[model samples]
Target: MARQNTVHAAAAVLVVVPTYNERENLATLAPRILAQGEQFHLLVVDDDSPDGTGPLADELAAADPRVRVLHRASKGGLGPAYIAGLTTGMKRGFDYLVTMDADHSHDPADLPRLLAATHDARADVALGSRWTAGGSTRGWPLRRRVLSRGGSAYVRLVLGVDLRDATAGFKCIRASALAALEIDTIGSSGYAFNIELNYRATLRGFRIVEVPIVFTERITGASKMSGRIVAEALLRVPALRTTSLRPLADVRPLADARPT
Candidate 1:
């Protein structure tokens, strides 16, 4: 753990937030994340949010050098947006990269704890887990809670990964670990992407740690969850379990990208 601390003491961190019609949330979340400290940078990847979220992101980036935005042509999916952002972060030489919900569901205040876990545990990835000890959720309906918990359990059983919250979205990953994944080839584009990435990291022998956090349901915008997204996840879990890890050299180089 001490080794990690020393290695990343002055490391640059990029928090990649994928957004879709989250203008209201970003109005507040962006400032809060920037306030975390100078060591962290914020990247908002907007999937052509029709609600003018992409323009808002540009305004934020223009106002602060620490903030940047990535504009996509259409609403592809969460996984691809993150892959694009992570690839951008890696190419730009960031030492650590994080992914979290753009909505207020993920508290910006808890980011420090996740970063601390990354250093303290010497972990290649730190998951903000609601299922781990000291973790909890707020404002979620009973049915949603049940589904999330059940989903994690099923993923663990199917993937044989020991993680408590395989579907957790808030996480910090060492750039080295991310680069090792050959992220461009990742197939899952829904919630299952979280499980697939975690499982892949485990197979690559990287240390993964969980940090407890309270996940609150978003108060604004609409939830992206849908029947099709859930079904895609269920179908992808078995495919991930059977796929072999790709070699680093085989990973296609991602083009350099910037805020649009």
Candidate 2:
């Protein structure tokens, strides 16, 4: 699964995928992500999976220059893992930073379209939307479909994020937008992180576009969705609406964001 060339130091794009005990998925996922294009580099931020996902990712990184691994001490929540990943991308001066799931629910093939959507629309964030026209899900249970739809709808209504799939995990974010939003300051530590990211970006008037993508249920391993995660998102959405999110700058013009 090794590619001939290493990721260039000045490569413009980086995809940060967070993993926890996703060894089965990682072995199959890394090569596909790398195959997307030569311009893309991948960073696997593993939460020190006791399942040995960390070592597996390290082996992949060793074989391929485009692949890199970030080993965290424990299974921190999705937000912290992503925060660390995005922060690393920005520090390395990448122009684009993308986030994805290691579960293969998010298609690696859709990666380019996300980046392209951001570029074509001059948007700061591109969401891989399952509710948008042309988007679909394969093998997803009806309950999950309902939960995702209802939750995102709630997020949209309460937080004013103007996207059909505001809670989507797959996304491509422009580095400039990351710095502008000050993503590090976001406080949510659970799955609500997706909504929080979009909400903050919208508040800052950053352009967010949706590209229809097919989300598939994993064929291997256990799903991470849990009661606590759902509750966290449910509790966090209203707080985001009521709480005041300070901007990176004291005086910045708020753009009136509308659905696209």
Candidate 3:
């Protein structure tokens, strides 16, 4: 399916980019996002950064009618920034909202496939998955790939989420799915946020589909991954599973609950 046709089939897609110190990457990515041959808009929610990413986002917004910028007071966690962007997109009447890394790890070329999946498959949420068929990562070191695969595996095994890439940052969410999501109640704000959203969506019975995409290394800037971040994700896995299963507790067990 063509980008234009896919976009028209859904409500206008508003790409929500939460930026912090991404000035070097923003300029090139912003225009490319606009030129995707789709009726999508972009919202840049920038946490105040010494690197001037916020100002550059403002400049981009001024130049492009489809681009908008939101300035946060300080460098907040990723989860809060995304929540702000999603809220803004919904309030502005966008039917679809997408979030992705700003450092170019996510390929703009693959965006059309995600939108097409949302349209053609009637998916409430479309994920750009690296673990699924035809999906792969390029130029990543062995350690990085192992980390990603391990994180995804841990999430699936713990939360019972079958998504190939439970921690994928690249995702397209239908407006109805967003509305159905209890965004405010989500607690995790880092890599764990991706797992939280997918788990919650599954628990709510939303239809999710994955599209394979080649994830490339960011052309600029250093990675934000940290040991602390990884540790936090490990801690949050059980929390997500517990939260997800709590609601279903009222349903009587089909067979007596098996001991772990």
The prediction achieving the highest TM-score against the true structure is 3
The TM-scores, one per candidate, come to 0.90, 0.89, 0.91
lDDT of 3 at 217: 92
Better of 1 and 2 by lDDT: 1
Shift of residue 237 alpha carbon in model 2, Å: 0.5
Error of 1 at 123 (Å): 0.9
Per-residue lDDT value at 238 in model 3: 92
lDDT of 1 by residue, 74-190 (tens): 999999999999999999999889999988888887776667656545667788889887889999999999999999998888877777788888999988989988889998898
Ranking by TM-score: 3, 1, 2
| Alpha-carbon RMSD of each model | 7.6, 5.4, 6.4
List the global CA lDDT of all models. 0.83, 0.81, 0.80
- lDDT rank order: 1, 2, 3
Q: After superposition, how far is residue 217 of candidate 1 from its true place, in Å?
A: 0.4
Candidate 3 TM-score versus the reference: 0.91
